[model samples]
Target: MKKESKVFGIYPVIEALKANKTLDKLYVQKDIQNPKIQSIINDAETLSITINEVPIEKLNRLTKGNHQGIVAIISPISFPPFEDTVETILATKETPLFVVLDQISDVRNFGAILRTAECTGVDAVIIQKKGGAPVSGDTVKTSAGAIFNIPICKVDHIKDAIFYLQGSGITTVAATEKSGSYLYDLDLKKPLALIMGSEGRGISKSVLSIVDKSASIPLLGTINSLNVSVACGTFLYEVIRQRNH
Candidate 1:
């Protein structure tokens, strides 16, 4: 198992938040009552940081010292601002390609997607800050260090990122079996951002509603579904094929 970097106690977490530190998640002791803790929770919520009301034993296992009913897991990697990453990629790449993940909670799947994104020349990978998997040690290892090479953007909402991409002349496409069109039929040579949804649920309905188009990979087999990471590679390779041909 990979050891996670942690910040325990109340004031330290507050200062970390104030300094704009990239935290994977904040774990607070369940049933604790304190005004300062409430303030911390509010601040964390505003920043879209994931919070878990865990037992004190969980906090104790995370660290040895007195936790003061709070502990924060620091992200192994920093996330670039979403708007800044988009603007930079748009300015630099002629036909920028991006990957937008909607609530991919599995660390291994997220890492696999990142590896594929880097391999397929994706401009950036965008994920929501709270609902998605943290950029932790497992993610880094699973990605084979591709996380360091590719720029990852953390956004407040997937829909916001899609709207921004659309406004910037990037066509947003969702990969879902619910779609009537096949992935091969799309013109993906242009600037594009491919959206991959979570494991249990495919793309969210609101996100599917706003995308430029929705595409599905053909499934001749009886499975009728694919692993999110495998499906992501299928989508990315199709984009590569379209662009190369």
Candidate 2:
């Protein structure tokens, strides 16, 4: 996927916002008291573009040209709202297979998981908006362009996603080492959303409480855990196997 475009300059940035550009984020000079800056801030607030105030040096570092204390980063891929993703998938009349990553901060792992998910025909991959990897150039390269092909939904909270999936009649299976149920034993031939947690902390306790089923991979060796991406792939393929059979 292409990198998000960065637009700088006060008038141009404001025009881009006025033209309804999908901005990834906006950066403004801190402590600017100009009326034009205040107008831009007001417009940004109305448009819901995330605004960050930083020093003039930071803006200078971003570009040597006249920035006029404003820069807007345009999103490359249009992120579909979570509700629209869910509704569209449900409208398809096919079994929905979603993968939700909880606090998975590693970019490579996130990309690898996306690659595997695309290969396995997953309907969508959901991630938290704040804690997860930002969909960037590295992620696109690592995902082998699967990031562009697959539908990725960003949510405010994984718990909210869990509840939404459950309400929509999709069974949520959390992949964790804490559970005794083997991946092989679970019934995976159903509309399901699989949750994969972080590498170090595992699934958050709050998320774990809401999952419909929790299963773990069997370890035959001394190592107690597998890499998050590897475990994600294993769990995904198991679902594929069950569904295919």
Candidate 3:
């Protein structure tokens, strides 16, 4: 497992948040109660930080000293704002292609998608700040340094990103097995952003509700669904194929 940049102890974590640090995720012991913990929770919620409730044993395993029932991981890279990134993309490209990752927690999977996005001429890769994988050294290594080459936008919620893209006239398409629609049915040559969810659970219901379209890949074998990275490659190449034809 990749080691994360973290801050343990209650007061240190609170000070980090007060300094407006960019945190990847926050882990709090389940059922932890204290004035400081309450303050931390309020700050995290206000900042739209992702919080995970873990057992006390898990907290003990993470650190030897006093963790004070809380830990926060600081992200290595600075995430760009969605609106600015979109504006920049529109200024240069007539029809831009972007990718959004929702609940894809594996750093390797996230890195692979980013690599594909870079190769396929994708304008950007958007992710939900809380649920998505943290961008770290492991991610950069897996991507073969492609993560640095690509632009990433981290938003508070996946659904919000979908709505923002739509408002900008960028067509949104989500990959889900539940949808009766086929990937080839829609024309993807226009300005668009593709939403890909994790294999365990496809796009969240709230996100699916807002997407312009939902599509599924054709499967011939016994496997129920395709790995997200593979499916993402197929989607991007299809866009390229349509534009070339």
| Winning model by TM-score | 1
What would the per-residue lDDT of candidate 3 be over residues 198-226, giving only the tens digit for each residue?
Answer: 86888889889889999988888998898
> Per-residue lDDT tens digits of candidate 2, residues 119-236?
9999999987665665666677889999889998877789999999999999999999999999999999989999999988999999999999999999999999999999999999
lDDT of each: 0.91, 0.87, 0.86
- TM, every model: 0.90, 0.80, 0.87
TM-score of 3: 0.87
lDDT (Cα) of model 3: 0.86
List clashing residue pairs in candidate 2. Answer: none
RMSD of each: 2.4, 3.3, 2.6
Residue 126 shift from truth in candidate 1, angstroms: 0.9
The Cα error of candidate 2 at residue 76, in Å, is 1.8
